[model samples]
Target: MAGRAGDRAPKARRIRLGNREVVTEGLELSFWADISHRCMTASWPAFIGGAALVFIVFNGFFALLYWFGDQPISNVPRGAYIDYLYFSIETLSTAGYGDMHPQSHYGHFIAAVELFTGIFSMSLMTGLIFARFSRPSARLLFADNPVISTHEGRQTLMIRLANERHNIIANATAQLWVFKSGVSKEGVPYRRFYDLPLIRSQSPALALSWTVFHVIDEASPLHGLDAAGLKAANVGLGLMVSGYDDVAAQTVHARKSYEHDQIRFGHRYVEILRVTEDGLRIDYSRFHETVEG
Candidate 1:
């Protein structure tokens, strides 16, 4: 009689063919990868590598023992190394169900070391997992306040900046990077970005308007930039800001990102520098689903 395919011991699960480990499937893999990355985040790689090497060494040693029919070399009923390996692993993992117990002194010693290693390694892994999950994802939104403003008795293409988080990240210092694009004698677009000097850094608590004075004077390249030209000319703004937290002595967490679509220009001009002043602030929590621009 021929055996069914399911009874074929040689034909194992398909996962064995791939870079997949049976134990590290599904949620386990996700959890382990995150933990591994975090553990190795600032030198987490070395530790994880070492752990892998140790695991390999122990696994290979036991497999060889099982193949060779080695004994416990004591008054212990030495089972095959395969039994020792399985029993050791179970004991080390603290799943002591008493299905198999060490009968020899040599077997007992091996079990002790494995149990110790398991406890230490598991505690370390757990710490890494906690830190990784506790850490927040860093993402932020910042848009230049206004393009045109009243400066030195002239309507200038000024850029203003401020922190958006109302109650979060107090005393956050903000920096602005501006990129201006224009065509030279060849009429091809030329671009340059510069860090703007702020009188006082961005602190959410300040509630002060920080202005980047781009003097669009007669001699300035920005002077001839009409509404359409200004749009066509293309100017980009970037902000990088950080602040010290006295309470935490370290920043609890932080997030920042640059986006241009947030800067909106309407055909109707409101003579206001700050969006909050003009009641045009962005809520950012929800979308209206129908945005004109």
Candidate 2:
């Protein structure tokens, strides 16, 4: 059997964002061309390990250069690569320990180049650390699954999210979108996107839980879609939330995605908020709980 048209395309990479892994094809970029981006996105352990490896490789290269030179340093030990490596470390770090001093012009030149490289690398590392620390991130928690049930005499779709940081988010806004695979009039296969209008998509101050709702009426894009229908069409849903974080003093955004099977129909979220004698209390333990409507 012949393979699909997309299978014949040159595959480039798979990138994961939110809950989707997008398959990109027909193009690729050189690693050096995007080194900065790669570094910024790398995990802390991986970044530190890579930096350490580079440091060792550079010091080893300089140590080899010193070993080939004739009596470049005044160290007592002769023909010792370990001693030369120690000297390279001291020079690269600019420690200038008087015990081992460069006595030849070749040694001085190598020391000078290593010193400059060390200074430049330290400055670059400092900048990268500062950038990573200053990057704004959202601590928003989303429910594992969305629910569909009757609300105010209409069938509705609902998604729940909370501010896990417990900080005020001013002028918070939300958007919901759906993707579905279909064939156009000309019989061309395509994936189409549609926006689902929500009843209340904005919150003046979101510090706790918020549930956005969308009535699945005749005008809605998901008006008549059932579980089987959604599965057959390969439907996917995405939710995006953004707001100005009062504590961080910057705009932060969060997003999540749901596959067709993750939607729970004929169900509603369990109550988590109650009025106590002191004030109001929320039971986060029940936040993700849902029951049949």
Candidate 3:
């Protein structure tokens, strides 16, 4: 008897699962299943969706049985359609409510399959929920706003961005670009772009928001530039930065020129900033180390 029960175990388990893939088919039933499968591997969703479509169509086969099975179609059985729909729902939920029992052997077989289908559906939904929540959504931390100040005779632009986990860059290089109005051969309105190299380098620290500066130098097209000139030019500054901690990703951003009046010349301005727990803090006073040519 024990051996017989043990032999029944696999079939019982199989009944509870149907085809593991079958439960994940159909838009209504497959919604959660698709989520879980995509969380597992890329190929699973296409397979799951296709499989669900097949399963739903197969359910329609059962519907056809109700509509035109061997059962008498001229005079419909009282409450029989309701009974089938209710049974389908109960079986699909593994509710085993027992309020409605399948009358025929065919009906019993269908109920058993649906009961198992529900079991697998529940398991896959659980897996997908956990997988989605468990995976980290990497974040990008930028400063509250751009800072504007004057350096020498020209206006400047600055912003602070920190690698909170110190993963974005270990020794990344950044190139500054600007698009502004410049006369061209077309004689029509023109916006020209140019690259500006930082006089200094990115710091060795990782978790800190280094104060990046863009001074409109005399050599620059931005040199002797003012807000109206920039407005006429329709200017924006782009930074192309690469090199980051191998563990995390890095991004590039474009910040625009500060208004000429917004900047204070020959004065260094300080802004409050925070750092990640794992890494370092910044000291712009060090950037002051540049010796005059």
RMSD (Å) of each candidate, 1 decimal = 13.7, 3.9, 18.2
Candidate 1, 1-293: lDDT as tens digits: 77786763342333321122343222223445575564545455676686677666765564354334345423224545556666555665678767566555665666677678778877976787677555543233333234454545665543443334333455666565655776788887787866655445555542333334445466555456555655565655555645544433445433232323334332112223436757765443321111221
TM-score of each candidate? 0.44, 0.91, 0.43
Which tens-of-lDDT digit does each residue in 4-87 have in candidate 2?
A: 776754557999866778888878677899998988999999988988998899899998988998878887397699888898
Candidates 2 and 3, the one with greater TM-score: 2
Which 10-residue span in candidate 2 carries the lowest summed lDDT?
Answer: 2-11
Best by TM-score: 2
Tell me the TM-score of model 3: 0.43
Residue 185 lDDT in candidate 2: 93
Please tell me which model should have the higher lDDT, number 1 or number 3. 3
Worst 10 residues of 1 by lDDT: 284-293
Candidate 3 lDDT tens digits, 1-293? 25654343222111122112123322243456665454555455665585577556545555445433344222335646654555555566566576556666665566566667667866766676566555443333444444445555556655555554545455655566766666767777776678765655465544555666776667776676555666666666555444545453443332333322333334453534337696645554443222221
Q: What local lDDT does model 2 show for residue 181?
A: 94
In TM-score terms, candidate 1 sits at 0.44
Which one wins on lDDT? 2
For model 3, the run of ten residues with the poorest summed lDDT:
12-21
